[model samples]
Target: MPQKFVLRAAAIAAASALILAGAAGSASAHVTVSSPDAKPGGYAKLVFRVPTESDNASTTKLVVSLPKDHPFAHVGAQVKDGWKVVKTTEKLPQAVKVGDVTLSEAITTVTWTAAAGGVPPNDFDEFALSVGKLPEGVDSLNFPAVQTYSDGEVVKWEELAKDGADKPEHPAPTLKLVTAVTPVAASTEVDNPDTLARVLGGAGLLLGLIGLGLGLRAGRTRKATP
Candidate 1:
């Protein structure tokens, strides 16, 4: 091959590799929520997990904004050691149910600040809150997040809302409320009609093709020789 052609092919391969690497890096930067469950008119512990670009620099601080429309939106958070918790309340149009009681409104924002010279790089921290009395007539919750980086970079993990949806731009984490269903019974393994027919059909076609190829080769060899 010509030297120029070889160099061009190498450059194309390098470009393709770089493109793939960039795509993978972007996918890894998403923030996720862990350990979430809420029962209607009940309290639960919600934990938010924030993964940084550089785990080396510990996550300095995290701020979670509660949804105003939620029943327990203004509920207070349980205090944690080694961190300072700040709560901001907001007024609501109607009352929200907490257990047997109804609350007029709930806290709007909850921020957790680390101690001075806080968590170092390359480490993770957990922010836990005791949430009380989830609202009624809701199945799922979506918690939006705002993450702060050591290098003065802030990332917002808020998604856009859809039509006729109760979702917010940067909503708080959510939980699913499901009723338990009992299983009826388990079935023994039996050959599936469609799958079995397909498997047999494929095997027969493969064998037929192999046989035809062998017969043609044998006939050609005979004609080529004596």
Candidate 2:
């Protein structure tokens, strides 16, 4: 191959690799809700995906906080291997009516703890739950989560997304409330674009600019020499 052609090919290859790496990193960033088929004022089964982030420890515990104002009338968790699921309930100061009944209490938090083993570094686990009568009053539900590592490190996933601002570093997992439409799959992973993706994309763009500058400089030098 010609030297110039080889150099150009190498630059293109490097850019492609950068783009893919950025994509995968963004995909595995944090805990997310997947396979959400819930509609406003309806029941749906959703899966929570948690990725182990500690390099020195395994993820041993997770606590997902439900919305207190728009609580789920019914929420059930699926059994997991080597893990215990616990629901903590709190009494409401004022009763809220639902489906011809008045209720004064609700499940505020769902916790999962590993019995023997846990999700190791670079690994992930998914927890499944069914919730009904999703609050129709809000546009979405925010489920802040607390993750505990085997080394006692606690990471809070409670940041909220601000209007017209970048996504919070540790934004809480959210489930948007939308009008009832065609039913979706049992669960789906979040495909939303994240900050890492944008940054990696910018890296790719920079590489293109560098190549353009090289080409223009080469053309000027050849003309001056002739």
Candidate lDDT scores, in order, read: 0.68, 0.85
24-64 per-residue lDDT for model 2 (tens digits): 89665998875558877778887889998767799999999
Kindly give the stretch of ten consecutive residues in candidate 2 with the minimal lDDT sum.
183-192
Which TM-score value belongs to model 1?
A: 0.57
* Residue 60, candidate 1: C-alpha displacement in angstroms: 1.7
- lDDT per residue as tens, model 1, 98-172: 666677867767887766644566445667777766666776666677777667777777775677997454444
C-alpha positional error of residue 20 in candidate 1 after TM-score superposition, expressed in Å: 11
In model 1, where do residues sit more than 4 Å from their true spots? 1-29, 55-57, 73-78, 97-99, 161-172, 184-226
Looking at candidate 2, what is the lDDT of residue 101? 55
TM-score of each: 0.57, 0.71
Residue 181 lDDT (model 2):
59
